[model samples]
Target: MTESWWRDAVIYQIYPRSFADANGDGIGDLPGVRTRLPYLRDLGVDAVWLSPFYLSPQADAGYDVADYRTVDPIFGTVEDARGLVADAHDLGLRVIVDLVPNHSSDQHAWFRQALAEGPGSPLRERYHFRDGRGAEGELPPNDWPSIFGGPAWTRVPDGQWYLHLFAPEQPDFNWDHPAVADEFRTILRFWLDLGVDGFRVDVAHGLVKEAGLPSLGRATEWHLLDVGESPCFDRDGVHDIYRSWRAVLDEYPGERIAVAEAWAPTLDRVADYVRPDELHQAFNFSYLATGWDVESQRTMIDASLDAMGRVGAPATWTLSNHDVVRHTTRLLQRNEGDVAGRKPVEVDPVAGLRRARAASLLLLALPGSAYLYQGEELGLPEVIDLPPEVRQDPAFHRATGQDGYRDGCRVPLPWSGATAPYGFGPDGGPSWLPQPASWAHLSVEAQEGVPGSTLSMYREALALRHKTLTEADSLCWVDTAEGILTFTRGAGFTCTVNMTDRPIEIPHPGVLLIGSGPFDATGDSVTLPPDTTAWWSN
Candidate 1:
């Protein structure tokens, strides 16, 4: 890969707890990921982005980090992390680890020290410790709501309240403090010394909050994809932090990079995180949230390209991640009425898979980086029926305005076998989250050699993309019917997606390279079935 390989790389996100288990303990570990390095290499991804594996109390699924330098016992030792990086590098794959800088676990040494040192201690200044309002100081510092629901502040025993934008157990840091910036510099050096390729900055837009901790002045429930401006997120001050971080990353070789998991009000605003001197890439969430229609997709794609182009950075595209519903289920439920009503929208699994397959083709054909969640290649649908007793997403307990059902997307993958656990761990071992018995038909073993399977489709598509597409960052929209979207990337590559519900005949573009589903071609035109995507060589 080139020095700017990330410009058009395919990065896979590995949610450690559900990816693989190496110790027979029903939990995924770094050793398990090391064992799968060859599999990822063969899958055609240029890098792997791992979610948090740091020391944590498991609140918010490891996002509440206790120690930035230590590996959680459930995930193996620090040596295992080093080994995984070495193994991944051996396979010519880069490794990007998650860095949760917005907050720290309540158990973190700094947070613990702040609590033990009382209200006036210097340690308390490292975090957002403030006096509350009202005559008796009983109310929170402000009216800001947690992204996970409820107030964003929690009172301490010493009559002071600390800020936490998600859970009380995860206390927000005061980026204004010099200690916070100095400590993160040390942490960055620690991981860079460990040989990892890059960092995925979790909540990258949330480090800096507006001064004075002002109130929102109105009640509002937060959504994961909320684009509204907030005093607590996407502040201008955040860019300075990334610029400093970019300096740290530049000190290392191998074009070490950082990708921001930022949720901004616009694609142009999101591009600010990826300015040449800031981070390397930012997720294009607008494209991910777009509905399954030609106009919506086209507008978002054009907007994303334009926004990133203005900054001279490559646009990144992703459909599913651990935080939201898997696209297989999401695309099928797009037309479901009133998602705001929080109704349990019924999903048609067959139709969902069809759209998901087409979406993958579209994602890969785009002229930028693409991110694939762990089980997306297998076409895993959201396991929406997990019993409440076994659910672990903190949002569920918080009763957030959002669906709070991220567990449905994080169920353990089905590698083999026909029963529960599905070979996630050792024989007879239990899984952290139960897999559906129906997953027997969706296992990697089940789809390994099956023709027309989603797994097979992804493998072929990725392989073809690398072989045919050039480094040229040009994409031109081709004129097509109302429900069909067609574009060409560079000279010989053309991709088209049919969003209509019926077969549509169009003039044949060129020799068919691959397609999401079967199609019939005559002398001058081809019949594309409903909800299909195809790639051709012009």
Candidate 2:
């Protein structure tokens, strides 16, 4: 691996609660992840980014961290995490753990002490505690609504309201407090000492808020991807905090890195988080949110490359994560058009998988780091039929403007069985979120070496991607027919995608390396089927 391995590298995201459950507790743990390291290493990814397994109340699915220094019992002990990191390194794979710096669980020792000490206590200053509005102090301090739902501030018995941009269980931290900053730095050192390769900083853009904690002035629901300036997020002050964190990472050996889970109004703003002196990479959400059309895809690709290029940073691309519906299902939904005020549209699974396969080729062919959410490689679709009683996403309870159904994508992975729990744990053991019965065919055991399986396709694409694109950084657009996007990377290497519904003919790029779907070649030109992508080399 190169010194800057993150650049053009593929990182797999593991949502621990659903990745694998080793102890039959129905919850995935560190040991389970350790057992899966070999699978990821074989999958050709350079690193694994584990979502928060930090000591937590499991509110917000562990994003509401109660302690930064220890692993949650549901996941494992501190030593377990240490062992996992060591095991990953031994397998020649890097490990990046999630760091939730923007907020701490309401159950955190600091937050608990602040509540017990009442207002004006020094501990209270570590969080955003403010007096309620109105004569009786009966109203929240501000109009800022939680990203999950309702007001962002939750009132306490002391008549003070504390800010929680997410759920009430997660109180936003006061980064201006010297102690808060010092504590996080200490936490970084703690994990660094444990041999962690880096951190995927959660809510990296929200650590600092605008002064005065002003109101949004109108009713608006905040979605994860909501752009436009906000007083609570993407504040200028957050950069300094990252700059300090960057210094700490540099102190460690092995080119330790930091990635920002930042959502900003534009790619330019997102690029700011990845400035040479700040974090190493920020997710290219714009590219992920782009529609499956040649015009939108090309526009986003160019914009993402340009924005990150200007800052001397490699852009990061991803399709699905723990927070959203899987792309296979999402793309199918898009094809159905607006469902607002309408019954759900029946999704055609075949079409969805085809588009997803084509999309994967496009993602890998791009010139930057790529992230693969677990299960996406197996072509898992969102489990939309999950009973409401089984739903656990905080947003679902809040009924926020956001879809609030992230649980659909968080179901435990299917490994090797044809029944419920499907090798996720001991036979007949429970899963925190139930898996769909149809997953029997999608299980890793089912897809493992099957030539046409999505898993096999991903393995092949990733292997080819690493071999050909790792050392190549240049991407030049190649003129092609309308509804088709084509680009060349290194000499004699080209990637083309057909976005139109009908087959389109284009000049023969070169010897076909791999294709998302079959194509017809006649003499010096090739006919690419709709929703297909192909790579070629001379």
On TM-score, the candidate that comes out on top is 1
- In order, the Cα lDDT scores of the candidates are 0.89, 0.88
- Residues 36-123 of candidate 2: C-alpha lDDT, one tens digit per residue: 9999998888999999998899889999998889898999899999999999988989999999999999999999999999998999
lDDT against true structure, model 2: 0.88
Q: Report clash pairs, candidate 1.
A: none
Over 215-308, each residue of candidate 1 has an lDDT whose tens digit, in order, gives: 9999987767773799999999999999999999999999999999999998889999999999999998888888888898999999999999
Please, what's the RMSD in Å of model 2? Answer: 2.0
The regions of model 2 sitting more than 4 angstroms off are 335-346, 399-401, 521-523
lDDT of 1: 0.89
Worst ten in a row by lDDT for model 2: 336-345
